[model samples]
Target: MANIVSYLAREQRTFEEEPFNMVDGLVMATLAYLRYERYDRLPARPSEPFRLHDVLALASWRDLLAGSWMRDAADSRSFLRALMASRRYRDAFVSFYVSESSDAVEKQFSAITLTVGDGCVYLAFRGTDGSLAGWKEDFNLCFMDVTPSQQAAVAYVSGVASALPGRIVLTGHSKGGNLAQYAALCVASDVYGRITRVCNYDGPSFLGDPSPRVGDPTYRAMLFKAVPESSLFGMILEDGSDYHVVQSSAMLIFQHEPFSWLVSDGDFLYRDGLTRTALWADGTLDGWLKTRTPEQRAQFIDTIYDFVAASGVKTAADLHRNFGSIVMSVASSTAKLDPETRAFILDTFKALVGVVGRETAKSIDPRTRIRLPRRRESYDGSRPADFARSLRPAADGSQLAEAGKPSHAEPDGLQLAGAGGPCPAKADGVHPAKADDLRLGECGASLPVPCPSAPSPEASPAACGGVLDKD
Candidate 1:
């Protein structure tokens, strides 16, 4: 299926010919918000708004493409360049009031406003940037009533609303989406009245109690939510707002990329509902989160952030570049944790793994039952490779067949057996299964490789491109 880039290339109609839709708003919001990072070099907000065409004319598209943010800054720039050349969006957006803040102790907030078409203003909030502070605020959403960025968004929206003359449309991707919803709800009655729509493009939901105004029927009606079928970030703490599940070309968590979302004739390809895998993940995560006390949740967040901060990497890009050294630093820091804290961390992780394993095992065919060898009674906090080695049978004892080796046959199919099982080798001498196919644990149930981190809500496939098939 074609995505936004291909959609833009195919459609040549202007706003007058075809009015703006959610997809159009989303593309504009993405471009307007992510490009603010480039404006850091500017002295301040210009007295007059700069049309996208004019901005691209004066600025170096090459240099803008070089600076990285958490999201797809390069692709967003590309889309802007494409939009500037197109009849559809060439004169549609004029950007103004770009600002960004970074406070290690509080949180990070960044936003920009664009006047789209003729009379409507779109306030686009930048989602979590590469800044560690920005990500920390994302975690804070679980506990806090209002994140620092949310507060800033409220103020920004109110101030901008006073100065602008036209109706408003608030929109954002990822954390920016959350901020857009929050700002729209918190704006004064007059400003709120002027809001045409509040579009949340796979933004997270509020966990704790939100403002009473958020529940107002009229306000809720103004909100529009959409998520990809295999969403993770969008499902977190999400409820109330009816969310549209859209088909995405990117796999698994990478579906968070707006560019991966399939577009047809200037609109997204809507799905019936979330994928079964997404539903299972949401249920599993919600259950796990409930098991943790508020204090435990806080501790876990703090501990993880502490480890990340110790590496002295301020941005995700920096961490990506020096991943090896950062990982080593994290390992060293992990070793310094008190025994009790260490135990708590390990036990929590173990429980989470057990949940995933059990859930995965349920999905396998019962007739093809494959049993794993029993695990040892105790587990030290050693490396995974060391633990695997320790599980190996004694030299004199019966040995488990290697991963690809055929061990035994059941009535239904080949069953992997424990030590002393027959090792029937194929003519090629290679095992039937590859190492990657072998699942860890006592049930021999397969599971997808755990993602290193939650995909950025607003990340573009072009920014961090890869594919992982769903299990």
Candidate 2:
């Protein structure tokens, strides 16, 4: 049963399937809650009183600092714990991870291996193959969001590019891809120049072009995004990257898996999709956001920041454990806040859930007009480890191991995988749909997992249920 579940889990992520960002979001929301709860538990006393606004400020700063300073998983967790402890308001909670008896606070790194290069650093969060047994405890607790990671990556690149002027490449799977592109746009020229390519296997799209920092031209040159043809998150927003929609043969949900796209050939196969629907949704949302008198967006940002900071949790893991209770508290308090802001938060929450639910449904069975073979499973049988090994050179291009040349690389070619079931492709190009249009259950039987912070449906196949059940 465990093996079957694992196989299905792997199948769900095959290149043909559309992936959900549920886990990443959950982690972020959980972290927010952790910070908030810890803040409240601190002993009443001392240098400063707890301020909801301070929590907001902390959240804002954390969002801005996610990938900055290049701290791998371990250092990040420790620094955050300490920062929270010292904030006066959280002084009593300062030693949560520390013991007075111990002179030094030991920091723990993720089970994944790290490869640091001259200008780039690569972090491989130990996955199934890695020796990080039980290390993946809370990975699926949240979905990825580029804003935080991009902010950090940009900061990291800015410093590196200034120190060494040359070509640079930023890359990551899922959330990392978004960060790579985001950092490229956020940094200064010297920093961006060092960035030659930004590879995002499948990251959520930007709200639109990044808030142009040093004008628009510089933002356009460095993006190289790719997604499996049936990708869910990859098609979320438009960043203007002519995304290579890979032709995939994977029978199941393929969008979530990266290896599913690796062909025997060294190159990926792709086909264009009717992106108009997706484009429409992107433009609509992005426009609505951008047109918001800066004041409106500011207010919106403030409201969420405040809401999360108020909870005082640290990592996503902390929040997920207690999100239901917290949500109830927020719902109870909503009546006390300004009616307009309260309505906005409630509406936004609904909208977010509806969007994911709807997309997951549609992606699972998009009346697909096209299907193509992405790669043969053989590539993965013996070569996947080797493939990752070659690319494993840290994000900075420092070689981690010698690239084992393949016995024979497959030639790149497109193969049509017959469409399954019903639901013909819509004639309209794949433009973005409105949040309302994205309502789930209107079409599909089951919605993909909702937000990471929310519990998985009780009925979800329990194959690997244990994987996330305890965490």
lDDT of each: 0.64, 0.37
- Taking the tens digit of each residue's C-alpha lDDT, what string does model 1 give over 297-354? 7787788788888778787788789999887887688788999998888777777786
TM-score of each: 0.73, 0.40
lDDT of 2 by residue, 1-471 (tens): 111112223322311122212121111212221223334333332212243334434554344234222122323444344334432222111111100111021111111111111212221111111111111211211211222234445554444333332234455555445555666666665444444444566666543345443144444434446666666556554434466666554433443454345332224555665243444444444445433433455465555545544666443444567789767766666777888878876766666556544444443323222232234422566778755554444333322323442222112221124534434222333454322211111111111221112122222111211112211
**Candidate 1 ranges beyond 4 A from true positions:** 37-43, 66-78, 93-95, 361-471
Residue 290, candidate 1: Cα error in Å is: 0.6
